[model samples]
Target: MIGTWVSILPPLIAIVMVLATKRVLLSLGSGILTAALLVASFAPVETVKHLWSALTVSFWADGELNTYNIFIMVFVLFLGIITAFVSLSGGSRAFADWAVRHIKTRRGAKLLTVFLGLLIFVDDYFNSLAVGQVSRPITDKHRISRAKLAYFIDSTSAPICVVSPISSWGAFLIGQLALILGTTTAVNYSPLSAFLMMAPMNFYVIATLAMVFFFAWTNIDFFTMKKHEEIAQKTGQLFDPEKEIPGQLKEDFPEHNYGRVLDLVAPILTLVAVTLGMMVWTGYRATQSLNIWAIFENTDVPLSLVTGGLIGTLLAAILYIAQMGRNETASYRLVGKALSTGVKAMMPAILILLLAWSLTYLIDILETGPFLSTVVEKSNIPVNFLPVIMFILAGLMAFSTGTSWGSFGILLPIAGTIMINAAPELLLPALSAVLAGAVFGDHCSPISDTTILSSTGAGSNHIDHVATQLPYALIAAAIASFGYIILGLTGSVWVGLIGVILSIVVLFTIWTVKSRRQIELTT
Candidate 1:
């Protein structure tokens, strides 16, 4: 961090370029080039060399390729394959057909979507795609907008995983906390305990969940959603058929009424069962602990996901292909085609993920985290105001990087160090602020994987999802900031609940006013 402020330039440049151009890949590439140039001491020749090496090497560094990166990518690929196979076999269509029969109303369709989203809490990536695959038709039948469907997918995905104790998100977060805050002498900060303490104070997660239910209950559609719903009603259009669905959204519904609703339910159950079993077994083996939390904290989570994905994918292929044909020979051929097509479909998302990882590595090399910590330590800000400050600043970091996990890695340690060294009692509030801010920012970011996947799943345009969801995410952030301040001032999560209640009330009031205005405008 030789140029302390320069360290911030990479992510800031990424953010600005994204807003200006909407080309996330180009923006990330430019940011990487700028950061690499800075890293190479601003020498032109060295900078070019650094840039080439980054493009060729860092994006798939052997270290990460062998261990962590490969696992994430592999799981995504297999998940894609499973989703594809399920769709081609009429599992998704069959389920939707069954659902629309019973769930005749718009409200029931939306609530069912929400319920399904909440049910698939094992991983956000899995949750987003799975819910979208199953629920899109149901929602479309009931005239729900793609924007609204995308919102439901995005809202439930990350926020639920952030607080879920047994999720991959939780495991990864625990690893970060254990690595960073485990050094403290003042507090015994086991990763699980830290997460537990901050859970109640995670106001944004709670508020976002509440906001979705509000939307479900009241059937509020303001902004672009109103127009979308109108078009859907008039034209029976589920998506913009003219504008291509940009990513791995190849949906060809062949008439395969052979499948039952159980075809969908069975595969999802197999995925869940295999994933949870592997997670527990691996965790227990690693830690030799009967305690589930300890087991979760100790598991080789990334590898477990890969294994689970592989097994679940295999089971899905067997179940789907078996039902697709009269003989095993034909089914085997179908499996081959589906697997190849599905994995290939995921290539776009995989490429984006690779670029994201490369950018994250560059930010880490620039020591951006330490620079941020320096800013916090040097500021003469009051202790109570610090929570709000941390919340806002962390949002900036996550928004820039498009990764809550990366921002969490940077901020959690800094917060812990500050708390132990100067303000011990404010530990819970500060931790809460970091977690809440990271999720809120990533929840809204256009380039974020979760956000991108939500759009991918719903087949909504990415910019549309970003434009529609950002306002709501910002509202959640504002409320979380207020909650953090209350927690800091009162030293109790109970008091912070007041801030949460107020945030929901404000949102509902706005919805009320917006509905009245819509009525007026129509008149």
Candidate 2:
């Protein structure tokens, strides 16, 4: 199948189908069925049966589902509950009030958003909702466009999660890496060690977090965002539909009468503590050693997350119950209601996560990874440009799929295989390129869950969020591409740092040019 060119058609068709139909489910289904048919060597009846089984059972079965995914899903569910309880307890509102007092200027507000987003590096969905909930009032007070606020929330979530060592995104990546490299000694570093090294090389993530400041501090806008900002400053019309109509949550927060800042802080602290403690326990269990480095390297991240997530939820519930102190039944009911609310809020995200995993499982059956590796290896492209190729292609796939996680699940394996076999030294840069591209693509994609959550959290018009964020994302992506090229040519991490600096310069230059053009138009 390495030389079998037909193998490439399924993913390509899936992407194209998405562009044409605007139906991810249909496109994914078509792609999966196509792969199954191919695997069946064009037996129509067998293909149908195979597709049915895959569609029905791939995400729940032993071979495909596995413990890691199960734990990840469970952790996600509990995390949703935690978010809801925090919001219901008035903890989020309380935190926002506290934070707003310190944020005297628009720059401070935006930076605070960045900081909060970074702090919630547990999961992407939680990051978007929590950060958006906390920062919106402050940004609105400073006349920042909802679009801009959405950009801040959206940019920080996935980008931060992907790089964090103890995050769900990190756990997912490790699980995938473990599958490929296995317990066998194929590489010198553990997956986590390699991930941390590649983290800095993630040009897009680095550029994105920095770009937020550039926009906030400079007060510059290079696209429609400028018009929205102007509208907000002039008319106080933040969610201006004339510019672009975008979808967002109807209600920002539930009508609640009680809550405190500590309600939020207590649960978050407990969560972090439990997570860390479990990591140590898992590490000790795995290696029977107290070596901190060894523990980190061998820690079972998914297990720790699930174990910690459940305890954290229960711990938060207890705090809420005690604080809400009333009749026993009333207190119990209050906590119970909040937990359910949180679970309900997370439903859409959970469904999307499941679908993304299912799609990946089906693609796995087609051996898309091996097929991609072969294609890259045999192509006429030079090794120096491989990172560039990977970034663009992976970005496109993510954009089409509306999911960075799914794209990573599909492309990382391919990228890893290609890098390991063709140029082992380039592994870190190559993996980073794939990761950066996936994040960039997900950032730009209208259908992405984080994008939707950002809009919802910021209370922005969904289309407006996408319209305004695209220019900023594209700016970061363009610079990231050049960074990859430089990394490829020089084969040096220092060269990658140079790329980041160049990206900032390019961004500032774009802002300057756009400002001049707007000034000229006014005159």
lDDT of 1 by residue, 243-339 (tens): 4353444645456567677767776677667777887898899889898777877767567767877887887777776764453333566677778
Q: What is the lDDT of residue 347 in candidate 2?
A: 57
What is every candidate's alpha-carbon RMSD to the true fold?
3.2, 5.6
- At residue 215, what lDDT does model 2 achieve? 79
| Candidate 1 segments whose C-alpha is farther than 4 A from its true place | 1-3, 42-45, 52-64, 172-194, 241-248, 251-253, 323-336, 490-492, 520-523
Off by over 4 Å in 2: 1-48, 55-59, 63-65, 119-150, 157-202, 222-257, 323-339, 393-435, 438-471, 487-496, 516-523
lDDT of 2 by residue, 239-342 (tens): 76543222222224444546677777777667667876887788789889986655655778778778877887887777666754542333556666766666
Error of 1 at 398 (Å): 1.3
Candidate 2 local Cα displacement, residue 251, angstroms: 7.8
The models' CA-based lDDT, in order, is: 0.76, 0.72
